[model samples]
Target: MGSNMLFVRDITPRKVNFSLRVKVMKIQIMNGKGYDSGKKTLELIVVDEQGDRIGVNIRHVLKPKFESALREHHHYILRNVVVVDNPVRFRSIHWNHETKLMFTHKSTIIPFESSQWTGPEGFNFLQFSDLKSPVLLKAGVTADVIGRVNSYGNIKQRGQTDDIPSKFINFELKDLSDVVVSCTLWGQFCIDFYNYMKKAGEDQCVIVLIQFGTTKDYIGELTVSSDWNFTSVLIDSDDVPAISDFRARLLELHANDNSVGSLAPMLTPPTNDLTKWFKDVKCVGLDDLRPDNPGIFVVHATIIAILPDEPWSYIACKKCNKKANTVDKNVDLTLNIDELLALERYCKKCGEKPKVQLRFKVSVRVEDDYGTASLTLFETQIQNYFDKSAYELQKSLPEDQDQPDELDELLGKSLLFKLEVSDFNRDRTYANYTVKDATTDSQFIQVFNEKYQTHKAGDDSYSFDVVKESSTSKVTSSTKGDSTSTTDGSQAVDLTADSDNSPLKKRIKTEPGTSPMSFSSSTNKPN
Candidate 1:
């Protein structure tokens, strides 16, 4: 019998089976601060049934009456508050100067948290001791990760707390099966992870390997914290193991009490040949690939262009460099200014700004199988193939030589290229390769010429063809040179205009736009 039939039978009056409907109860609300055009206010509360509260200070909530009530009183509660899940956290706020009001609000909020939650049956939990140190996993390891995220305090300067600023991001590690502990990343890692989470949302799973951490408690629940000395974190995505299938195997191994050595290292099949695979493969936009693990991919491309090389310098005026001021002075006016100005205003090492030549770059509008993208090529790479250093080539050219010769060659030529793409996090990036080889293919030129001719001819159906043929005749021939064994047998045919009977008179005209004239005439009696 089907499960639905069983359910129907149980619900019927004739049946005596008993069932219960689950209802969630008990809510906790968090207190947070918010601001508007006129006043600072308190915002909505984030709560869980377990009596945990997370503060929410969204700007949109400030426009409603709830914000005013919460601000006047330290707290306010709605009797039958409609529970909305995954409210966006305000990441940034932008205001309009003219209107003197908030114009835009940016937040990191997801509508569903299911992608960030793990159930008992979801993943296989390995004990901390069983895992090896400095292990690596591929990007394809798992579909997603579910864990509790917490924010640690910012990093302050040692000598002056007001100067250099940094942030720390901490995550409490738990899965469907077991709870390990917590891990924290400082400085750049904190910034990178935060950006990745904000962009990837809750769907993408990030594989994190923890080193040297111990269990502890913050308030009442048991949590893990990393000691600064021994622990480190790395995101791995190489040779992604069979996580889903491994769950069953893991349980069997535990039942058998097997050691970690008994398991073999996971291996992945080799990647396909890029040139062969990508030739017919369709793309929409900007494609990104990374040789490294944890890569980013962006699709759909347009407005494809390249930026040529420009000169850069390492030095500037010391006084103006340190000070937050702009300095403008000619290279030759050092003497008069130095006498009148303070010694502190001494002329630093200054010269006429060296003119830098811009190299040829290529840009293309492309669409990947998914979306559109813009691809650009730098002058250095183009010069690399032409056997010329960018500096040497640019310096020797005249100011009037606006376009470099190398660039002219590549103006319409197609070539194979690769690109690396990254979002907010530099670590979580990828690379992609385009397989078109523009140099060898002449088909593009032919197509271009045909299109040009069609437009000029005003008839799209016009076509041109070349023909070759052979004609023969018999004739008596004689040579006036000495007959005694001529050493050189080579002879030259005279093609100049001749009034005598000549074979050239019978040749057909091949040039286009000429009148349709004939060469052969009525034959005279030859006998």
Candidate 2:
């Protein structure tokens, strides 16, 4: 205790007279991005004896002077610190102020031994139910959120900041009330979230506490992204005292309510956002694809040979995915699975000729320096690259050949493939390595390579030293756009092949909804 000891509530801007004693509630060590690249910054949120907290910024030059002395949850006394108006627009909802502290040349942090502090660790966590309130959601403020991890999707990449690309991964955080708040995390935060989830596995409890996270109105849906540089992430680690209480209460809530075990393994990753999905699936070399593992992983490889061993087209059900005996007379597709099943259109065990759609399933051999594997492309990849649906292609080609010779054009062409290794393939029940998606667009591949090219020091972490994406017009692989663009919904430039003999002779896009039954070819003659 000192005569000049100051509480956080009484601190003012540009003050240098008082010595303040506070508990280091949290400390974040992060590498600088954008303009502050190559420099490291230390951010801390310290709480006084009364539980009032203020953020502290330690510059790179003065970081070494106070780095070792600051320990989270420990008492420290600061003297001659510079206080300034905080520039961070969005701050923690409840525990926030207009001013923040900074380190000066004379600033010092001394450990205090004779501690009389008996206060909470200053985490003003926001409730999940309150996330829906217009005042909370619409207000330009940061929030502290703590909840059980429900599910997470692949990375959602948008733009580059100072040549380093920014990424977002979305997941749901469920509180004890069964209320869920969607979270979008960036950079190292995303890495740590999965790191804890992977370590916790399916049986253990994995609760998280994000301090000073951001809130955004993403197309009317509320999402919270942890602040990029300053956000403090507390996962299942025992170092933080709050996690024990959170874990216990969450468990007791479900247990007392008679809900059996810990809320874990809802693994329902999102799929609707194709722009985020197709490219961000984990990229793996051919050697990395294990037979025992079953998941969608990307492979950047060349089309070595089109395996002529399987039929490229088969009669398929329009109402569902089941194979039909022959073409159905009625093309009136029942919208729902129940309605289709009620009308005797969909069946797994029985032979039913539902309104037929021509299925395009082609097996192609792909190879890179790592190894070689057989990959099968479905209808979307086939039509987009070939500029024709399975039905139209079937109508145009000669009936005698199993597949047209033009398919040979795909050989030697490089593609980024989204390969799905299912349990069937793992169990040897299915022979082909199926591709969920594939793209021939070079710009998309450049971004993919930058993201997954090199693994960082930690598990599942990526070296995101990405260059700014080409803003010039692109021939992207996304097809959900207009007739000129490709599948995954990314915009691209006008299509053109390299030379006269290029495999990409006609770069017309074939969007997903191109009906297999809606062919415009009039005669029985081949096109």
Candidate 3:
């Protein structure tokens, strides 16, 4: 493509020496001479005139030789570079090559000069649908995804002492394909995203590109998350052609829709809808959880008691984060320390024996004014309520104490609970409601409630009317006319009838925060 330049796909092990003009996407400065048999090295990810990419390990001695060429998103020419096997388990990028390029004797890199042939930014982004691909879902397999921020959640930080606390937040990314992918950002990346949204003063049409992100199968659903130093985030990056094209396409698709730019107001709403429940997807009472209705519902409740003597934590496969089992097929729920360390655990999901970590699965009885129900809080949601993890809490206990004192704190604390309901939990009194998410923050709590129970009349909350939503239909408008349309990527009958249904937190401060699925016809944006 460029005089005498070989594309990344053309390189092979049969020919160890080659010349190529490539764009560098900086990888890590791998520590020590230790990894490569006493040769401390630097690895850079590079892309050719085509969007294809490969890992290039600068030989330890050659690391310094090429140190000055380590510019990200810059082009360069390599002469006489070598090839080696791609042996690492978690690859930097998702190229299917078995061998990687290397810097060897006589290898040299010079800055690429031709701007006319600059192919692309080298981002081979994963389709939103590809996030479910097992190959990409590997613990460290980097996945790149691009979409406009559909919705987001609060910035939740946790640390026993506040020194370098573990901070994380979740959001959704939606493509023009109408597919929505869940995203979670950790550490400083989470903080950076939070700051951007805080400044925007409200959630609006912000397009984001997550590069080198890791994917996880959270429960049964897939999620893409930032991988510490390996990942980079791009927000409304106008200079990048791909992003600009995507934004323009999004605008084109709904150009005349009139409801443009109404991304569920971030800083303030035009009205006093500070406590506006999104799309009028009202919050429900605990007693409102009926067997016929099954969808994720947010309820404000307090923990009444921790169901004791039940399993509070389980051994989780470190790689896949699923329940790990002993060879004989027993859940590692009650393994003693000696037995645990001596035995091997298997993860059916990964099909491999893996090291294990303790994870929380605490069941607590919670109560709203209407009634009390049992809920099973898992590791992700429980960690928000307790500074310490189940393992840490158990380790801190005295020999005679079976439960952690942290359970004492969860009691009486009113929280906004996002419960995922299916018909399987029809018997609300006995059914263990599995939590999708929970928040103790009052600001987020208010946004979660539909006026905090407008359904309540006297003490008989059950006496109030309940909206029977059909899977096939929903009412998107209040006018008495049959309407049909899609709502948040879902098929719905905007019936004059109520066949109904279901349904981001940047801080708008004192305002009801955003939800993972929210909508408004606001059409307002920050300048």
- Compared with the true structure, all predictions reach lDDT values of 0.28, 0.59, 0.60
lDDT per residue (tens digit) for residues 1-527 in model 2 = 34377788787775566888888866776565444579986778777777677888788877777777777778888887887777663344555568888788878777876346666656777788778876666544677788877655444334211111255567778887878777877766665565455444444456778776777776565667776555667776545566678877877667754332236534334222333544336766676776578877877877767776566655445544344442345756433323433344343434554555565666776776666776666555655467666666766776566687767767777777777777755665343566755665554466556555553223445533424221222233432111111111112222121122223222223221101111111111101
Global Cα RMSD, each model: 30.2, 23.7, 14.5
Name the regions of candidate 2 deviating beyond 4 angstroms: 1-5, 14-16, 26-42, 59-64, 105-108, 138-142, 160-165, 191-205, 219-222, 232-234, 238-240, 256-262, 270-527
The residue-level lDDT of candidate 2 at 315 comes to 49
Ranking by lDDT: 3, 2, 1
Better of 2 and 3 by TM-score: 3
Residues 365-462, candidate 1, lDDT per residue (tens digit)?
33423333333343322433556544445555566654345444444333323343323123322122222222111221223234334534665443
In model 2, where is the ten-residue run with the lowest total lDDT? 513-522
Model 1 has how many clashing residue pairs? 38
Q: What is the RMSD, in Å, between candidate 1 and the native fold over all Cα?
A: 30.2
Collision count for each candidate, in order: 38, 9, 11
Q: What is the Cα-based lDDT of residue 195 in candidate 1?
A: 47
**Comparing 1 and 2 by TM-score, which wins?**
2
Residue by residue across 408-496, what tens digits does model 3's lDDT show? 76677566776666555443322565665565544344444434445454332322232211111111111010011101112221112
